[model samples]
Target: MRLRIKREDLSAIERHSKQSFPLECCGLLVGRRTGTEFEVLEAVPAENVKRSPTLFEMDPQFVHAVLSRAESRGLTIVGFYHSHPGVGAYVSGKDAEFLKLWPGVAWLIISATRELIEERRAYVYEGDEIRELKIEVY
Candidate 1:
């Protein structure tokens, strides 16, 4: 699968990640999906109710609002994006558990610090398994 995101939106994620550090930042990727491609239209930042450096939990009410807004704009929840401050961009145990609730969507993780973003990695859920995806920034 391929996850395509706008350069500005990726930059926005980086900024949000840095602003939320040393805590994790979470957000939704609003877009359209066709076949094996996800085209991200927006990166909607959501509050991390967990407010912990190693954990993140988005507000369901906030998510609902985003869902409604996306639907109104003919967009869908293409994926989820989050930051791992000071850690590598890899799925964590907590993240794995959360993945179970959201299937068939891209999971984009960005590793960052207060100063800069380190790396970015993406995955998709398929047939009860998560597989890495190729990311394209436009």
Candidate 2:
């Protein structure tokens, strides 16, 4: 399946990736389900920073908070995003393993280096296997 991201959303992702350089930054992909398409509503960054790169444990309190906020507005958590510093935009073994646990959720990995920022890639997990999904920014 293809995931279409608006220009504004893409910009937000880029900004967050740059702002969280060196340390992986994570956030939620909020949107509504629409006829096989997920129209992105917003990209909500996590305020807590207990978990950094190599690990991401979304605080239960924060999750509840966001869910409560979203509930009132009729939105939902669609997927998640994170950055990979110095690594290419490809699924690593650890990522694959993680996907096994969070199946059906979209994983967006932004790769950045000291000199340049690589393209972002999205994937979905299906029974321990990660299937790359097409991403169209703008």
Candidate 3:
């Protein structure tokens, strides 16, 4: 599978991740799924209620609102984006469990630091394993 996102949208997500610094930053991936690709149109920033460096929990009310707005705009909530500050971009144990709730939706993780954004990886959970999805930015 692939997540096709605009360069600007991805840049915004990356910038937010950096701005959040040591604390984890999180957001919604708004787009539509087509064929084998999730065409990401926007990366809507969301409040990380956890405010922790190791864990992130998107605000429930904000999630609900984003979902509603996307639906109204004829878009789907394809997945989510978050930064793993200091840690590399891979699905953590907690994140793997979180993916179960959203099924096939892509979970985009930014491996970030104050100095570098090492990687941007996206994953999807199916059955028992976390599968990596290729990301395309244009």
Q: Per model, how many backbone clashes are there?
A: 0, 0, 0
The TM-scores of all predictions, comma-separated, are 0.97, 0.83, 0.96
Candidate 3, run of 10 with poorest lDDT: 124-133
The 10 consecutive residues of candidate 1 with the worst lDDT sum are 94-103
Candidate 1 per-residue lDDT, tens place, 20-89, comes to: 9999999999999999999999999999999999988889899999999999999989999999999999
lDDT of 2 at 34: 61
56-115 in candidate 3: lDDT tens per residue?
A: 998788899999999999998999999999888988889988998778888999988877
Rank the candidate models, highest TM-score first. 1, 3, 2
**Candidate 2: Cα lDDT at 70:** 76
Q: Tens digit of lDDT per residue, candidate 2, span 26-116?
A: 7888777564455667888874274465555567788788867877899877677877876777887877877787787778888865445
Question: Relative to the unseen true structure, what is the C-alpha lDDT of residue 65 in candidate 2, on a scale of 0 to 100?
Answer: 82
Q: Compared to the true structure, candidate 2 yields what TM-score?
A: 0.83
Residue 130, candidate 2: C-alpha displacement in angstroms: 1.8
In model 2, the clashing pairs are none
